[model samples]
Every structure is written in structure tokens, then in C-alpha cells.
Target chain A: MDQQKLFVQIALHSWNTQIARAEKVFNSYSESEFYKQIAPGKNRIIYLYGHLAVYHDLLKETLGLDTGKYSVLSPLFLQNPDNQESEMPPVKELKAIWNEVHCDLKELFNNVAPEDWFKRHNAMTDADFEKDPSRNRLSVVLNRANHVAYHLGQVVLVKPENI
Target chain B: MDQQKLFVQIALHSWNTQIARAEKVFNSYSESEFYKQIAPGKNRIIYLYGHLAVYHDLLKETLGLDTGKYSVLSPLFLQNPDNQESEMPPVKELKAIWNEVHCDLKELFNNVAPEDWFKRHNAMTDADFEKDPSRNRLSVVLNRANHVAYHLGQVVLVKPENI
Candidate 1:
């Protein structure tokens, strides 16, 4: 296995591990617990899920894949910092969006050609690529994986029903 | 640049960003805030720091770097789940250990040769290397960065002053 192939495997594995960890936390939530904050004035389950759903919207374009199924979420959940008060869709609606968005992403992942993984992202210019040749699909995947793991740790800390 | 050099730069940059982001959260703490939880039944600030400190102790060996310190923290903070009450050092003692550990690590990072970045980590063999070429000093650094980012999100949510 060459380094590029191995790097893609590691990055994808990391992304899968990170997403599974976060899903476990979200799966454990009960109805009431979904809206409860990790700490006072901190983000709740609904907000975090919606935020991630919105942010993953960028991953499509960033990875040279396709997107655009969740723009309605952009206004309500995207711009505000976590825990900021805002009008929100019902939990069921956000869950639907989250599922739809991730399904599209996974489908895109399956269709990407092997050589596409090494291609520069859409925004990379010739000069920028020269300076940081690591700016490719592998870097994008690794970065998003790290981003997911960071937020996963917090999502797990929501106030427990018994606490 | 060749893929090897690009990989090293990406790994080091990721590690540095993760460390800095975590440090920014810790540096914002006051004396009392360091002991507070993200929320009820979640990790306290000091405990998370102690936990990361203990875990990073393994990085020296994992990356083929040297280590001579920080075993004292292993029992108190390592292996234990967060929020479990236990004996603890004073904040100053843990902070001292954290500083010493990182100083040693930074020195180790500086001393690692360019070729060393692609070298297999301790215990990795010919067969394993062929199967997972990404398993090297660079992967260790990148994995540790993701780990730190996970904990940093929790460390940042320590109960706010006003809310």
C-alpha cells in the first residue's frame, strides 16, 4: 500500500470512528434530554446536531463532491454560536435533515474515483497548491473528522436525565 | 514537495493547532473555574487537563521520542473515566507536571529528523507497515491532535461566570 492510499484509509477510518462516537451520544438521548444543555448556558443535543448537519453542508464542495439539500438549516442553526437562543424546527425535522444530508454525503463518498482523492479542492489555485501540496481530499477528510470528534466530546456531556 | 514532506507538515500543523486551541481554553480559566464541571456529572476542567497530560505521556514512546517524567499522574488521572471523584494534586502541582511534560515533548519534536517522520513507530514491523503505511510518527501526531481536540471541546464548556 502506498502512502497516499494508506492516508486515505486512515482518514476515512478516523472519520467513521468519529461519526460513530458522536452518534452513540446522540442515540442515548431521551426526549427531554435532547433539549438540555451540557452545562448551564451551554448547547443542547438539538442544537449540536443541527449545527453539525449545517456544517457538513460544506464537506460536499470541499471534497469535490455534490451537495445542496439543507440550505433551510443555514439560517436557523448555522450562523449563531452554540447555545445561542434561536427559533428552531422541531427535533424531528432537524433529524430528518441530518439523515438526508449524511445519506447524500455517503453516497457521494462511494462514487468518488480513486484518482479524485488526490485532486486539489475546488478553491485551491496553482500557487496555493505549490505552497501547501497537502491540501487535497485526504486533508479535507482528516480535518472534518477532527472537527466531528471535537464536537462529539461535548455532545456526550449533555445534562443526564438523572443528573 | 514530495508526499512524505507534505504529510509531515500537515501532521505537525494539525498537532500544533490542536494543542493551541486546547491551551487557549485552559488559559482562560480562573482559580475557581478550573474545578468546575462542564455540567453536572461531566468532567471538571482540572480533571480533563490531568487526563490529557497523562495520555500524552505515551506519545514519547509511541513516536520513538524519549521520556523521563510524568508517571506520577498516571494513576490519578489515567484509566479513570471523567467525573469520578478521587484523590487529586493541587492545581499548581498538575500544572507544573503539564508544563514539564510539554517542554520535554517540544524538545523531542525539535530533535526528530526529517527522515524520522516517515519511520515506523515503535513495535511496527515490515508486514504491518505494508498493510498500513500511514502508521508512523506522522499518524501518532495526527491521532493525538484529534484526541486533544475531543477533550478541548469539553474543557471549554466549564460553567460560565454569569450563566
Candidate 2:
């Protein structure tokens, strides 16, 4: 296999693995469980879910793909910390948005040629990219994959004690 | 830059990014803070630190590199859940081990060529690896990088809430 292609595949594999782990945790939690904080005074699992959803939704634009359809989520999930004066969407609506963002991201990511991932996304100016070309689209995926795994660790704290 | 080499560098960049984040979280906490649990009835921050230390130690062997010197920590940190009958190493010693493991790993990893990371490590049997060539050294790094980030999230809950 071409080494570069192989590298991309492996990166994607890790991304998928984290995403699947997050999905498993999300599916396992009851709605009430999502409301519970991972720790005292920390954000709840639902907040983390919404955080990831919005980040991923914005990721499409970061990839220089389509603009995110869920721009409204940014204020609730991204700009502010959880438990702001504003209210978050219902858990049912957040779940749908999560599913839709990932579905769209999967298709959008698939359309990108393996080589094109090396190019800078809209997030970077050409001058800045030239200064540090390491900030490519694939790096975003790598970083965000770890980001997902990071939050998943916190989210798993809501697991029922028995099992 | 060659795309293949660039990919390796970015992968390493992500690995280093997570490591720095983990290190920051580990360094920020006081020794007493390390004793605090991420949540009620879960593992303490110190245990997770030792957990990562032990895993990174074992990773040397998984990479077909040097045997881990910290094998003694395996039973305390890896095999059993927190609060077993056996006692863990002191916080001071665990911190020393964590530093040592990462120091050794950094040197060992630098020695391996970019292309060499694509080769299968000893942890996988030849036939099994042949069936799935993606199980390479680089993949291990990617997986473990996320593993570190995952635990880092849980560990951060031990933070002194003001920040």
C-alpha cells in the first residue's frame, strides 16, 4: 500500500474508533443519566454531547466543505460553558443534531481525496499555512478525534454503578 | 515536505499535543488533588497517572522496542481496579516513573524511522498482522495518544474548580 494512503487510513481508523466509542456511551445512557454531571459542578453528559455536535458541525466549514447547517448550536454548545442563563435544546433534538452532523461529516469526509487532506482548510490563511503547513485538514481530524475521546472519558462517568 | 514524512510529523504533533495537555493537567494538580476521585467511587487522579505511566512503559515492548522497567506497576495500576488489597507506589515515585517512561519513549520513538512505523510490532502475530496490516507501530501511537487524552479528561475533574 502507498505509505501516505496507509497513514490516512490509520488516522481515519482511530477517528472512527473514538466516534464509535462515543456512540456506544451515548446510546447506553438514559436521558436522566445524561443530565447527571460527570463530577461535582461540572458539565453534564448532555452538554458534552451538544459540545461535540456543534464542534463537528463547524468542522465541515473548517474542512473547506459545506457550511454547517446547525450554526445555531454554536452559541449554546461552543461559545459558553454549560449552565448558562440560556437553555439548551431538548435531549431529543440534540440527539438528532448529533446524528445528522456525523452523517453529513462522514459523507463529506469521504468525498475528500486522501491527498487533499494535506491542504489547508478555510480556517487558515495561505500565508499562515506557509509558515506552518502542519495545520492541515487531517490534523483537525486527528485533534478532534482525541477531543472526542477526551470528553467520552468524562461522559462515561455517568455509567450505572452495577455493571 | 514529502507527504509521507509530513503525515508522520503531524501524527507526532498530535501525539505531542495530547502529551503536553496531559502533562499540564498532571502538573497543575497538587499531590492532595491527585488523591481526589474524578467522581465518587471512580479511580483517583493518581491511579490514572500511574495507569498511563504503566501503559506507556508497556508500549515500548508493544513497539518491539525495550522491555518496560516499570513492570512492577502493572499489577497495581493496570490489572486491578483502584482500591485493591495491594497498595500503590507513593505519589512521588509514580510521578518519577511517569517522567521516566515518557523520557525513554521520546528517545526510542525518535530512533524509529518514519517508514519503520508502518511495520508490524511484536504484539501482533505475523499471520494476524498479514490479515490486517493496519496494526502497525504508528497505529499504536495513534491509539495510545487518544488513550492519554481520554484519561486526561477524567483526570481534569480533579481540578480546583475555580479555574
Kindly list the per-residue Cα lDDT of model 2 for residues A1-163, writing each as its tens digit. 7766777788889899999999998989888787888888888888899999999999999888898888877877888778834677888999999999999988987888878888997888999999888889888999999999999888888774511
Chain A TM-score by candidate, in order? 0.87, 0.93
TM-score, predicted candidate 1 vs. hidden true structure: 0.85
Best-performing candidate as measured by DockQ: 2
Candidate 1 C-alpha lDDT tens digits along B32-69 = 78888766767778888888887787679777687646
i-RMS values of the candidates, in order? Answer: 3.6, 2.4
Scored by CA lDDT, what does every candidate get?
0.74, 0.86
DockQ, all candidates in order: 0.48, 0.64
True contacts kept of each: 0.57, 0.68
Looking at model 2, residue B12 earns an lDDT score of: 87
What shift in Å separates residue A90 of candidate 1 from its native position after superposition? 3.5
Give candidate 2's chain B TM-score. Answer: 0.93
Model 2, position B123, has a per-residue lDDT of 82
